[model samples]
Target: MRTIESYLRMLLIMTLCYLIAEWVIDEPKGTVLFNPYVLGFLFFIFLLVISFEVIIGVLERIADQLTTPEQRVALEEAKKQKALENKWKKRFAEWLIGKQTTPEAQLILEDHNYDGIRELDNPLPPWWLYLFYLTLIFGVVYLGYYHLFGGSDQKQNFEQEMAMAKEQIETYKKTAASFVDETNVTVLTDASSLESGKSLFEIHCAICHQNDGGGAIGPNLTDNYWILGGDIKSIFLTIAKGGRPGKGMIAWNNSLKPQEIQQLSSFILSLNGTTPQNPKAPEGTLINQ
Candidate 1:
């Protein structure tokens, strides 16, 4: 519990547990640590760490009570040997901070005194100075590469990003047309959308429904009567999956894009209450408007 190995082992265990949990849950969106399950797991690990520390402390106390004078001496010697083995690590850490002055060795300023508190002349930490030097180097490189070399600035970057976003939107629009099903389908009412639908209906549906949707071999569409339910969702389903069994209208889900089907459905609904030349007789149950 007092060793670096103990902390590393705990970290390894927590990482493995996190990986397993992520694999099982497989949710990639949002902040990972904010996920409820991950937060719960972290809480569990905290409890585990507390439990291990308590257990180890208790065991060490018990072992101390059981040890003889010779064994206690041996343990102290072993601890001293272990400290000597890790002495280099301590030295390395101190080197990272530069030369430091002990309290007794510190030089107190003669004039800088406030409320009896004196200032000590202390050297800056090597790590902080090194970081400052790195920043200076980075600044020079950045200035040369950007300001001097005429690299794209913020406005140019924004324009490029906007162009990329526009392209992505256009791509999504093209693909999104096909990403529809009965559950999500809706009637498209825009003139251009309806015109596209009209063209599709004439090419594919006119044979059975007639050119004007007055019904030919199929049931009357201009009337409120429908073979299946006449709601937008029901019509979408009917169009996508087809009507009843073997003798019913063939499924158009494969032949037409979902957007096209949506348009055709909208046009079909528009036909209701409209008069057509040589309209066929209604066959299905009448639905109240």
Candidate 2:
């Protein structure tokens, strides 16, 4: 029960941290609430916090197992004695310096006396020197990792990713043409094809044509009037060829398979007479029902 409670608490903390991080990063953008980068960063921060808590908790548990109450008391007493000895040593050193008039002590002191100013040359603390050395070691490790695997250089990573994507796209195009042959493409009016077409349209086309086929960048498909044509073949041809030059619709012949195009044409035909908000003014010949 305690373990379950801990897990639940951790989950709640992580959720709260994510919400806070998301809110902080998304403060500038008021219109759209969901930002992928913000969400990713929030998730990363939550994971980091969880990792830190787990590591510390594990270390504490290990420490508890290693040290008994008696051992802890002994350790504390030893630390106290060491601190007292250090304090006495400092006081003795100060007293000895006050009484120092020897040639060695005089030589150690500088003679640039102004009012009551004195300077002493002290060696760097051993702990500070060790810390400096550790910092240099850390720097070397960071540099090696970043150069080898992290790809800290943004331009290089961007170019590499772009190259990879381009290669993949080329391979896809080569395989795609076999399935999207223009000559062998047949019109689809079947229910299964129409459903597939609807799914594809929702994922790829809805951004421009909208969910209800109300046009934003593309023409409305629901009304009888069409921009290119209302007939299935003409619609398929227009989709294959794209809109008139410079009208923003690119030839989807490369992106979509021939059968998929037929399905999309069927789906468009299925949308006839469906109502949508802000439909564009009728532009093509009105196909009589």
Candidate 3:
């Protein structure tokens, strides 16, 4: 039970450390910045490190718990002997190497050398050698998934999706246009339709036309003056096809559906007699009657 509690406490400390590391690594970049992707990556790495620590800790606790008192004493003695043996071996190797001439010393050196300094052809420690080999294998697997299997290049994928979305919107507009007839230009005098039109206009058209349709950038639609035309169909056409080329008004036919243009034109008709705070001076022909 004590061992279990100790392990839990250690795990808690490790978890807190992981969280701190993640927070430090993923902190905001700019003066008031935030980055979700960096935060997410930090969280992922944190989880991996915590998992490794927990597994190793649990295994160590179990091994310690299983050891008998006598066995523990014997194990300590064995460890001391092992340490002494390693120390002597290192000393012997250094002594033997020191006795050799520099030219003779190069005979036992490996082919790889750095700046005339040659590495001794000593065998790698087993643990380090295994870890190095495992890392190589991990690299191959990571490369296969992230590069070869298209795990990366998310920006390219997003651009492709945007293009596809644009294409679908164009296709829908074309299909909606085919359904329009002369009678489709119904006046939105009904309260419900006018309210709906107001909402849509506020979201999509308010920036240019102003909320009350007393235009800011585009021509004012309140007074009976037709930059394109004042009639329902002409209004619909103007709004749908947009104003003249190089004009600030873009082609709404691409952005808005044909039905939306009809509703918007109806809304404009409703605002014919209404006044706004800053009405642009009337342009185009004045429709008398």
Candidate 4:
């Protein structure tokens, strides 16, 4: 007589309790037992199921009290529902823990001649005993395979993982976004790269070079003369690795990525012959190439 909703609600509660218990047991093992989002979704479903059950139950109870005949029917239905529920529960309990006062447990009780106490020697579930045996056999096999005989070890696994990661990086580098340094990089002449480089220079190099590539404390970047060397490569090298000892230029390789350095160097190469107010005199060897 119990509605399907009641059985479904009990099943849901049992499932929730099982999952929560599993999480609690495994939380200390440092492995992620469940996704938080999934748990949140399950919790929401449980709430909805519980709320629907309560509302339906309340409405049914209210309707039953309105008439004596309806009330009597309701009482009888409630009794039948309780009995059915109890029957199902008892069956499940017996299946889970085995039957109580069975021949096996009785035999254990009689075998022990205690003065007044009887030890309830209920045998362990078959499923539990099988699993226990499985673990023991698995442990022996694992010990022999991993410790005694030759097998893949943690070191080999780690090395293999590192090798795979390195291969992936190498493959990625072949895809055009790899690191570019002054040695292998060429000046970008594209409009977008030049614009990006211009913005980068204004933000970083502007303090020393001043706005508009005009020299301030730093040498005139617009001039062809160069202390380090004047081509795209030398300018990039100077920008990346810095000037000679005590020349006030420090390695910019750390501040800027290789692509950015290439862009900024291209922008500087375009600055040759630009007019600047109070331009510092050129001090580096001029390269015509």
> What is the lDDT, from 0 to 100, of the residue 23 in candidate 3?
57
The CA lDDT of each predicted structure is: 0.81, 0.74, 0.74, 0.79
lDDT of 4 by residue, 1-289 (tens): 2464486566878587657656665564433336575566666767877888889899988977776987688888998788687998756655555565656557765456578776766778655777889999999999999989977899999999999999997776667666676656787899999999999999999999977787888888898777778888888889998988786878998878988999999999888888988788776677565
Worst 10 residues of 3 by lDDT: 26-35
lDDT tens readout by residue for model 3, 1-289: 2344455555676567556655566455341123566456556755776687678779988998999999999998998788687886546544433332456655777887789987786545455667889999999998998889977577988999999999997777568755552345667678877787788899988898898888888878788877887888888877787779988877788888766777788888888988887888898999974
Q: What is the lDDT of residue 261 in candidate 4?
A: 92
Q: Write the per-residue lDDT of candidate 1 for residues 173-247, one digit (tens) a residue.
A: 667756666666777778898888788889999998888888887777889888898888888888888988875
Best by TM-score: 4
TM-score of each: 0.43, 0.36, 0.38, 0.52
lDDT of 2 by residue, 69-117 (tens): 9998998799778868888654554443333245665556566778898
**lDDT over C-alpha atoms for residue 156 of model 1:** 93
Whole-structure CA lDDT of model 1? 0.81
The parts of candidate 3 lying over 4 Å away from their true place are: 1-178, 181-184
What number of clashing residue pairs does each candidate have, in the order they appear?
Answer: 0, 1, 0, 2
